[model samples]
Target: MKPLLVVFVFLFLWDPVLAEMHKKCYKNGICRLECYESEMLVAYCMFQLECCVKGNPAP
Candidate 1:
């Protein structure tokens, strides 16, 4: 019973916003105001931001 209680407490303390600044973008890229010339937009982020990844240089 004590082990089960500890597991439950650990689960309850887990936070979704621990990395709120770049929640959507992980090792792939980052969240920014806009994707620039050398970056590509992969997804949308909170507060009108964008998840961008490095891309090939523009010709």
Candidate 2:
């Protein structure tokens, strides 16, 4: 029972985390150009741009 509960919890959170990767790409234009291997880079770049700049997107 405990194991099943743990699995369920993980599954619920896993989908969101995975889905966010694609969502992040849409939020940033560069995502269309990025490959699977470049996902982390795109996401990091987006996060930094969001934090570093005000309203302006990263180039």
Candidate 3:
């Protein structure tokens, strides 16, 4: 029971950190493109953008 409680607590705390990281990276990519920066420098950003867009579709 103690281990299960620890696991649940870890998950609850982990999600927000992951989400914040994702948002930061996403915004960084958008800023790079908006400033007309080179794609080669932020190529990973392109992939991230595509993945998020595809993962979440309009209702």
Task: Report the Cα lDDT for residue 6, model 3.
Answer: 100
Candidate 1 — number of clashing residue pairs? 0
Model 3 stretches astray by more than 4 angstroms: 25-59
Model 3 lDDT per residue over 1-59, tens place:
99999999999987765554355344244322222212322323432332122122234
What is the C-alpha local distance difference test score of each model? Answer: 0.71, 0.44, 0.42
Tell me the TM-score of each prediction against the true structure: 0.50, 0.42, 0.39
lDDT of 1 by residue, 1-59 (tens): 99999998877764532354456574477887778888888777766677888895455
Two-way TM-score contest, 2 vs 3, winner: 2
Q: Which model scores highest in lDDT?
A: 1
TM-score of 2: 0.42
Ranking by TM-score: 1, 2, 3
Residue 13 of model 2, lDDT score: 84
Could you report the Cα RMSD, in angstroms, for every candidate shown?
8.5, 8.0, 10.8
Q: Tell me model 1's lDDT, rounded to 2 decimals.
A: 0.71
Q: How close is candidate 1 to the true structure, as a TM-score?
A: 0.50
The list of candidate 2 runs beyond 4 A from truth reads: 25-59
Q: Residue 49 in model 3: shift from native, Å? A: 20
Model 2 lDDT per residue over 1-59, tens place: 99999999999887755554445333443422234432334234332331121143346
